[model samples]
Every structure is written in C-alpha cells, then in structure tokens.
Target: MDADAAPRRVRADAERSTARILEAAEAVLAEDPTAPLERIADAAGLARATVHRRFSSRAALLDALAAQLAQRYVQGLAEARVDTAPPVDAMLRMTETAFALKLAHRFAVQLTASMTPEVQGGLDRLFARLREAGAITAPDPTWGRRVYLALLHEVNDLPADSPMLDGDDLAARAGLLVGTVLRALGGVWPPAR
Candidate 1:
C-alpha cells in the first residue's frame, strides 16, 4: 500500500450515470418496449454515446434487463413467506409481487408478444408450485405458460394512462385468472357456500 500517494477520489459519478441509464431504460420499456434508445438516454440525463458505452446496443440492453428481471423474480419467490395462506391468495400474491415489487409488470406482460421462451426457465418452478398447491391446473406440461400469458394480457387492456398498478389490482386479477384457468382445466377451488 502506497500511503504517500494522494488518495484517489471515488468514481461515484460513473456509478450514478450507469444506474440512471438503467433506471430510465427500465421505466421506458415498461410503458413502451419499442421506445428509442435516444429517448432513454435523454430521460437518463446522459448522451446516447454514454448509454451505448454502458449497454452497448438496444438488444444487448433489453436482453440483459430481461435476464436480470427473471433472476430477481425468482429470488422474490424463493424468499416469499406465504405459509398456509389460501392457495389462491398465495398464488395471487406471487403474481402481484412480480408485477409491483419487481417493476416487472411490463416484462411480465410483453413476454408473450415477444415470445421469449427462455424466461420460463426461471419461472417454471414457481408455476409448478402454484399448480401443486392447487392454485392453478396442470392441464399440460406447458399449461402454466399459456395461463401466464393469458392472465397478463387480460389486465393489459387497462387504459394507457392508468395509474401504476398496485398490489390489490394485481392480486384481484391474478385470483380471477388463476381461478378461471383452474376450473377450465378441470381443477377445483373450495366451493362457494
């Protein structure tokens, strides 16, 4: 260690710049996946060159973001404490968590349109658990994938200028979708009195 050398200032600015860029990109993509890179850069208060330096290109940035989101969603599921709740409620909470806390609502919704099957690798286990718990039905090996896409799009019809979705809306729609799919697939929910 060379104590005699002047202490180097921390590179806080570079870290902040990169974080800003990613945050802006995520926000824009949530609202409009096709938003331009230059628009994201402007939102981040950085030059397009700076954004490119960090993300390299649009596709690279989008892929990395999706991969990052998948990992985060899985981690949230693993750490979720849903012991003994109504099976339907537990499943609903998990879906809402993915949308609200993960800021992955757009990722969750648009995945079908993009048809990126790989994200299923991270999510499949959670879907399996939901099915085993009787929150959903295992109509086919890939039935959860179909239900997930369907449930998300059902809510996607919300007006473009609606307020940010919250836990309540997430859970309500999730319950309806999962419940319907379960019955449709020949599974059952606790009967109404």
Candidate 2:
C-alpha cells in the first residue's frame, strides 16, 4: 500500500505544480506577453527548471493557457445555467458570469480568440434556443456571438483596481453590456435589470 501511495502522491504534486504554473503564466503573460520563464517561475514560487520540466517551451505554456481558457469558458457558461433559465434572466446571469471570468482571465482569452469547435457548438446551441424562444431575433449566431464577445472583452478592459468595481458596479456594468449587445442582436428591448 505504501508503494502505491508513493506514486499517487507524486502524481498529486505534479498536478498541483502544473496548475500553479498555468495560473502564474496567465497572470504574468497578461501583464507582459513576452515575460520570461523566470518571471512565471517566480510567480508560481517554483524553480524555472520545474516549469521547463512541466512545459517544454513558451509555446507549450501558451498552448496550455489556451486549453485552460477553453475549459474555463465552457465551465462559466454551464455555471450560468443559461439553458435552464428564462432568456432574459439567463442572458443577464451569463453576461455577469462571463464578465467576471474574462476579467480574471484577460490574457488567457486573448491568446485563444477562436475557441475549439466544440465550445463554439455549445454556444450555438444556446443561442438557437434563445432564438426559438423569441428571446432574440438575431439572424446569425456568429454575429450575435461576435457582438457579445466584443462587449464582454471591453468590460474586461475596465480598471481592475478601481474602487467602483464593487458588486453593484460590476453588476451594472454587466447589465449595461447585456442590454447593449442584446439590442444590437435584435433581442427584445429592455432586458431585465
């Protein structure tokens, strides 16, 4: 049992390090896209060698960042429960959740502007449902998606350390973005605040 436990512990440690590296990469790269491996290692509180061992090169690190962003985007959508709620309610919730996520992962999303087909398909399905329910009248899912992303991305550019970034202010920002995008998408006027 001890022998089996040794390998499990090693695996757990590796996973933890990998997660740390990915997170550190996101923060560092967001600030300096050309930041060196040493910066990321310092941020992760690990040696540069450890990061090299986990990720062979800068490209590899960026690749991992893209994958993480894709996963996080899907998870954010799922957590918003857009499919289960009314169109306006779901849109607001999803907008708020997505804004929060994008704000947190600014660099990751920038690196992965075009998501995998699987992620895009999921978004398509959600928008289709909204259209069928008459919540939105956008003729093209891609257009609606582009408009929504543009709005969300702009919100992420807001001053991070601003005192106005409290819950109410964030919610208001999300509401504003949602209202603007929905209107642009031919969605009904006056989304629930």
Candidate 3:
C-alpha cells in the first residue's frame, strides 16, 4: 500500500508541474511566439531540464497548445450557462464563452486561427458524443459541430492586431458571430429557440 501511495503522490506532483509549465509557456507565447524555453521555465518555477523532460521539444509544446485550444473551445460550448434564453441567444453566449477561453489562453488562440483537421475532428467527436449522451441537445449533431467550427475557425477570424479587442467589443462581436451562424444553420430563432 505504501509503495502504491508513493507513486500516486508522484503522479499528482507531475500533473501539477505539467499544468504549471503549460501555463507559463502559454503566457510567454502570447506575448512572443519565439519566447525562449528558459524564460518559460523560470516563470514555471521549474528547471529548464524539467520542461524539456515534459514537452521534449518546441514543436511538441506547440502541438499540445493547438489541440488543447480546440478541445477547450468545444468543452466551453458544452459547459457554459446560457439556458432560459432563445436557442439562438444561448448559442451566442456559448460562443462568447469559447472566445473568452481563447483570449484567456492567448498562446493557443493563435493556432486556433489555422485549426488543423485533427483539432477539428476532436471538436466533431465531442459534439456528437455530447449530443448522444444528452449533455447537449441538437436537432442534428453534425450541424451543431459545423456551426461551432465556423464560429471558431472559418468565420469571424479576428485580426492579429485588431484594435476591436476591448472586452465589451469582443463579446458583442462574438454574439454577432453566434447569431449569424445560427441563422445560417436554419435555426428559426424569431424571438426564441
């Protein structure tokens, strides 16, 4: 039992360190894509060697960031509290949640601009699974994912240096994007769902 307990504690510490490294690297990347690993390590309060051990290489970290960003967007859509509104309004609020998550993880947000098919697949799978599980309701599971994918990547691509990024403005734009997508999806959304 003691042997098993020691390993469990070790695993927990490793999980915590991995989270710290991700947070530090993401903050650095948000400001400069070429930020040095040593700076990330310093911010994470870990040795550079530790970061290397966890991530292996620069490409590995970037890959994780992109994948994480896409998945987080889908998850936010599933989890946000936007009930009691028209379906269209709820959809818009969920879009707001996704954008908020992206801006919060600005490093990953950049890669989401050119979201890879693998990331898109994750989004699709999550939407389908959630719909089947009744965690979310969708008239068509594919349609739900398509709408989210458009809002996240295809449509409403913000400029890298867009001045229209103040908190309130960004959110308003997100609502517009959500409204547009819902209308396009054959969502009636007259005054309600």
Candidate 4:
C-alpha cells in the first residue's frame, strides 16, 4: 500500500463519522433538546467514546451544529436568488428554502441563533426591495421580517411525522406559509408568479 493511503483512509472515516454524528444529533436534539450525548451516540450508532472524541461537550457539539446550520442557511439564501429575482418570487423562494432548512435543522433553529451579519443584511435588503416593489405594504421592514420568520418557525414546529412534511405535501405547506406571510404583511396575494 502507498505510505499515504492509511492516513487518507483514516481521514475519510473520521469525516464520515463526524457527519453521521451531526445528523443524528440534529434529529435527537430536535425531539428533546436536553438529550444526553449518549443518546446522540445511540442515535448515530456510534460508540459513546467516539462521540466524546469528536465533541468534548454538548456545547461543543451544539456550536459545531450551529456553524453547519449557518453555512446551510447561507447556501439556501443563494439558491433562493433573493437578490436577483422579482420581489414576490424571491420571497416565495426564500420561504420555501427556509422551510426546508428549518425543518431539517429544527434543533439548530430552536437555538434562536442569528445568522451572520452579512446574511442578515442580505435578507433585510430583500425585504426592503419587497416593500419598494409594493409586494408588501408593511410600514416597517423589520416587522415584516419578524412576521415571516415567526410563520416559518410555527410551521416547522409541527410534528416531525406530519403529513405536511411528506413528499409533495412539503410544497403545499410552503405555499400556505408564504400565503399567510403575504396576507399578514399586506403583500400581493398569489405572489405574481
């Protein structure tokens, strides 16, 4: 075997283990935020020592999860085309993307962590554009954003097994979320697709 092969294999294994742990942590913690590391280890089908070796403490694990979530949120924003799309279209896209992310990372979202300033600023700009385009008539863009986020949170808080989260039902749930946000914020209905 090549001299470097063993080290490369070890690194790959470690990466897979870390990913598994994070995925399990998200699911386990979403159901019970106070679940112990042993519970997460069980969920991951990993030895407790392995989990401990990867994350020294629950806080460390949560910090890593938060960082991962932040990265995913940024990517979702980009995929939503928030800057370039028409205001109503952008809002709907963003809502759909956020609904999926929040549902997948319920524990992280429940942490009440704020996005990086740059990402938050981008979202603020999108809301401003929405107002400018008369898609939303909310006097305060901040209020509009809060209302939008709250709606997403409520929707994602539904039981994990809810039919709304299953397959084609996800799109329906997202549409309802967008429609409610639009109505609450005095935005154009049916979102001018």
| Best prediction by TM-score | 2
lDDT of 1 by residue, 133-191 (tens): 65555745366757765665665455434543334465555555556656765566542
**Cα lDDT listed for each candidate:** 0.61, 0.77, 0.66, 0.80
Ordered list by TM-score, greatest first? 2, 4, 1, 3
The top-ranked prediction according to lDDT is 4
lDDT (tens digit, per residue) of candidate 4 on 1-193: 8999999999999999999999999999989888999999999999999999999999999988988887887787787887888877777777777777877887887654536665676677778888888888887767777777777778766775766554445676677777788788887678665
Residues 13-123, candidate 2, lDDT per residue (tens digit)? 999999999999989988998999999999999999999999999998888888877887777667766677676666777777776766787788777543777667656
- Judge candidate 3 against the unseen true structure and give its global Cα lDDT, from 0 to 1: 0.66
* Candidate 4 weakest lDDT stretch, 10 residues: 160-169
Q: Give Cα distance to truth, residue 11, candidate 3, Å.
A: 1.0
Give the runs in model 4 whose Cα sits over 4 Å from its true position.
1-4, 157-168, 191-193
Q: Model 2: how large is the Cα RMSD against the reference?
A: 3.1
**Between 2 and 4, whose lDDT is larger?**
4
Q: Model 4, 94: alpha-carbon shift in Å?
A: 1.8
Alpha-carbon RMSD to native, per candidate: 5.3, 3.1, 6.1, 3.5
Estimate TM-scores for all models. 0.66, 0.86, 0.66, 0.82
Residue pairs of candidate 2 with colliding backbone atoms:
none
Give the Cα error of residue 57 in candidate 4, in Å.
Answer: 1.0
